[model samples]
Target chain A: MISFQHVTKIYPRNTIAVDDVCFDVEEKEFVSVVGKSGAGKTTLLKLLLAEEKPTQGEIFFQGKSINEIKPGNLPEFRREIGAVFQDYKLLPSKTTHENVAYALEVIGASDQEIARDVPKVLEIVGLTEKANNFPEELSGGEKQRAAIARALIHRPEVILADEPTGNLDPYHSLGIIRLLLKIQEMGTTLILATHNREIINSLGKRVVTLEDGRVIRDERRGRFIL
Target chain B: MFTSLKRVIRSGWQGFFRDGGLSIATVFILLLTITLATSLFLFHGLSHLLISSVEEKADISLYFKEEALENDIFEFREELARISEVKEVKYISQEKALADFTEKHKDNPVLMASLAEVGRNPFLASLNIIASEPGQYQAITDFLETSDFTALIEKVDYYQRRSVIERIFSLTSTINRSFIFLSIILSLVAILVTFNTIRLAIYNSREEIKIQRLVGAGSWFIRGPFLVQGVLAGILAALICLLTFSLIIWSLSPRVETFFTDLDISQFFVTNLWQIILIQFVTGILLGVISSFLATRRYLKI
Candidate 1:
């Protein structure tokens, strides 16, 4: 459902973060983008989200050029894809439930739907008990779970998870990976960008590995290979 | 649309209570601004009252010679009244002026004896000419000096009193101008301070704003709460100021009257109560809403 045509992103001082990369993911596919730090993995997802424009080439989502999305319509475009970052990105002042419910609220969801869906999603993330707690009051795992709950609340067509488990312990990291697997099994497209060796090796799913800003390998049953 | 608006307002209300420190700080800044603006508004009126009282003391009196008939003095009074520059003209007969002088110095034996020594009615029938403006007195005195009946006038007191009148005129204008300048500076300071406070509050929420944008919240959805917060602060500040001013003005009226007997400030406040409330309400709400609106716009671009 998403395609990148010879995309390149060059920063100031001539740094090539992504160099003429090309890839596509079909609807409901689970794609793992593997790279070490500075391997252009994050930059690829950022292009899809339209957070940054590629210095050259084009990106398309559902066959529509993402660059063509007007500023006025960007919010609607974004509502189609959910994002979970390494930092959790939960509002510090909002309670766990409020953070999750915010996604629905922004779209003018009815009170009954929000009341019904927020808790169900929180339950899926196993954070139903901590619904009223603020981010600062939650543990690292709880905070990550809350962030995941928020990303899944609206049942977005695609979930772009960039280094979501970067700050977790081995157990919590594995738990998060399994949660993502559960989400993928439920037929949601998942684009995971991470440098973690175990996650890429164990997933062994459609892997597009990047090395020095170029995609070096693409395999259906890929493994982590330096 | 109605559903969206209701949600936006509720979100704003929640955000207000959620961010305690920022909300309190915003309300405090708005309150400070409202108080300053309201006081300056009232101060402008009070200064006008004081200036007018001083102006009342500077009118020129034309005392006619004892030989000038009452009819001539009355005719002169009628002519002076016709001058648009003149605010008022008072005719005091010779007998009335003497009676006034005796009544004023009744307890002062020296002045009483001096007045009695002058024997007969020594006072002249006079026409007191008060001009609309301090500068206009010059025109009135010039008319008096050049009049055909100048021969019947003993003296135009404007020349002798010109220095005092001129001093009052300059002093009133200076105070009037300085107050206006000071009010402008204070208002600017108030606006900048509130703007900075709101900017800082929004800056604190920058990361959340970025996340919210990515979460698919529309710009208005994200900004709704802050705007509501601003308008809420404005309403609160306006109410507080209104109650405070009303109580203060009502209670302080009698006490302030002792210092300026003719100026009943309490009565003025009572009469203009609605107008004052409206000004404060509009000022507080506009400042609060506008500053928040601007502060949020800079961060919502993401």
Candidate 2:
């Protein structure tokens, strides 16, 4: 459902982050983007989120070109996709429950819907017992779970995990991968970008590899090969 | 719309309580600004009263010669009353003047002995002329000097009081102009400080703002809470300032009355209490709401 049509992103200082990269993922597919550091993985996700505009190419979501979406209509486009980052990006002042409910609240969800769905999503991420704990009070794994809960709370059409386990321990990292798999079972498209060899090898899904700002490999049931 | 409003209010309350330190700082600044505003209002009232009291005390006294008939003096009074600059004229006869002096010094032995030694009215029978303005006093004096009855006039007291009256008039005008200028300067500074404080407060929430945008919250949904917080701070600060000013005026009223007997501070407050409160509330709310609105404009666009 997500497609990048030869997108190239160049920063203002003439530094190219993503160059002429083209790819697509069908609906309800779990796709992993594997690359070494600074291989345009993060840039790809940023372009899809419309956080940074492509310097020379267009991006498409479903059948519509996202590069042409008006600035005012951008929020509507973002609501359809959920994103989790390595930082967890939880509002430090908010409790785990608040962090998850915030996503629903932003979408103007009804109070009843929020009260019901938030707890359910928190339970799915195994954070139900720590709902009242702030980010500083939680462990790294718990923080990532909270972030995952926030991403899945809105039942977005696609979930983009940008180094979701970059800061977690191996055990916690495995837990996050399992959580992503569980979410994919619920029919949500999942795009994971990471340099983790174990994750890429275990996924048994489509893998796109990038090098020097360009896509160098696209393989089915791909193994981790840098 | 109601649902959105409810959410906005809830979010505002959450943000206010969540960022306790920043929220407290914002409210404190608002309180200080409102206090300054209220004090300026009170000072304006007191200054007006002082200036008017001085104006009331400034007047010209026309003394008639020993041979001038009472009827002639009364005719001069009528003619002087016709002058456009004259606000009022009171004619005091020699008999009445004598009686007034004796009544004023009945208990003072020295003054009583002196009055008895003179055996006749030592005071002049005169008409006291008050001009509508200090600048007009000189015009009245000139008119009196050139009148047909100037030969019968003993003296005009306008010259003796002219410099003092003019000084008081200039002082009052200077005070008024300076007060206005100072108020403008202080208000501008207060607004700038308030805007910066609110901007910093919003900057702390930049990440949450980005997240909120990603979740498809409309710009108004995110902005409504900060605006509400500003308005709340303004209202609370205004109420506190009103109470503080009322107490201050109450406590200082008796002492201030000693210097300005005609003005009743408590009475002024009581009469204009509603109007003062309205002004304070409007200023507080406008400052708070506008600052919040402007500070968050750039951040909310994302």
Clash totals, every prediction: 0, 0
User: What TM-score, to 2 decimal places, does chain A of model 2 have?
Assistant: 0.98
Q: How well is candidate 2 docked (DockQ)?
A: 0.62
lDDT of 2 by residue, A147-197 (tens): 999999999999999999999989999999999999998999999999999
List where candidate 2 sits over 4 angstroms from the true fold. none
**Model 1 clashing residue pairs (backbone):** none
Residue-wise lDDT of candidate 1 within A189-214, one digit each (tens)? 99999989988888879999999899
Residue pairs clashing in model 2 are none
**Per-residue lDDT for B147-166 in model 2, tens only?**
99898899878777767888
Q: Please state the error at residue B233 of candidate 1 in Å.
A: 1.9
